[model samples]
Target: MNRPQYILLPVSPIFIAISLIAAFLLNLMPWGQFIAAPDFVALVLVFWGVHQPRRVGIGTAFCLGLLMDVHDATLLGENALAYTLLSYCAIMMHRRVLWFRISTQAMHVLPLLLLAQAVQLLVRFIVSGKFPGWFYFVESFVSALLWPLITVLLLAPQRRAVDKDHTRPI
Candidate 1:
C-alpha cells in the first residue's frame, strides 16, 4: 500500500531555534571525541537549510559554525566556513532532494556532509599541517546514515495537522 502524502504545516521559528540549540548542546557532550561521533550541528543545519531555506540560511549556519569554532577552540571561522558552504549547497539542492525518498535523500546528503568535513580537514591541514587520518571522514558517513532519523524527528512538528481530526476514535 502507498503512504499518503503529507501536507506539511508551516514550521515555527521557535522550533527551529530550539532544534539548533539542542544540536549544539548535543555536540557539547564529551563523547564528541569519538571518531564516529556525528556532528549534530551540521546535521541539523543541513536539515533546516533544505527544509526551510528562508527561515534558516547561510547566516544562521555561519553563526552556529562560529559558536562551534569557539566551543571547539580551533581557528576562528573553521566551522563557520564549512557550515556556510554546506548551507548554500543544501539550499541549492533542496528542490531536487525533496523529490526523493528518505534513503535516497540521505545518499545525496552524504557528499555534502563529506564536503563540509573536507573543508574543515583542509583548514586544519593548512593551519596546523596535520592529517587526522582516514577515520576522520567516518563521522560524515555516520551522519549520512542518520539523515533519515533526523529528518523524521526535526520534521515532526510540521507534520502535525493544524487542527486535530476528531471525526473518529483517538
Candidate 2:
C-alpha cells in the first residue's frame, strides 16, 4: 500500500507571540473613553483565522478569551464564549473571506464583530441584570474600520514575497 505524503505548514511562533503581546497591550492601553477600540484579541483571532487557521482556531480563541476574562474580572466564560463563537464564524467563513478585498472583508467582519459583542451583551445582561451602554458596541465598529489597515499591514510581506517569486525570470 502506498502512503500519501503530508505537508506541514510553517508555524511562526514569533508571529503568534507578537500577536498575543499586541493584544494584551491594546487591551491595557488607556483609551479613557475617547474612542472604544476594537478587541485586539478578536482582531488577532481574525488575523489567525485568515492567515493560520489550522494552528490557531477556536481553541486558541477560547483560551485567550478566558485570559481576558481573568484580566478584566468579568464573569468567567463571558468573553470566552463570545470569542469561541467568533472564531468558529471566522473559521467557517475563512475561505470565502480570504477571496474578498480588504474593504469587502471589513464589511463582512463588521457584522461578525457585532454578533460577538451582542452575544457578550446578552450574557452580561443575564448574569448582572444590567445592559452595558451603547459605547460597548463601539468596539465592533472601530474594529471594522481598522480591518482594512490591519489586513494590508499584515499581508504586505507575504504579497511582496509572492510578487518577487513570480517576477523572477525562468
Cα lDDT, all candidates: 0.93, 0.80
lDDT of 1 by residue, 1-170 (tens): 27567888899899999999999999999996755899999999989988999999999999999999999999999999999999999999999999889999999999999999999999999999989899899999999999999999988988776779888332
Best by TM-score: 1
lDDT of 1 at 165: 88
- RMSD for each model, in Å, please? 2.0, 6.8
57-169 per-residue lDDT for model 2 (tens digits): 98889998898899888999999999999888888888988666778899888888999999999988988899778878888988899898887666554443323355554
Candidate 2's TM-score reads 0.84
Q: How well does candidate 2 score on lDDT at residue 9?
A: 37
**Predicted structure 1: clash tally:** 0
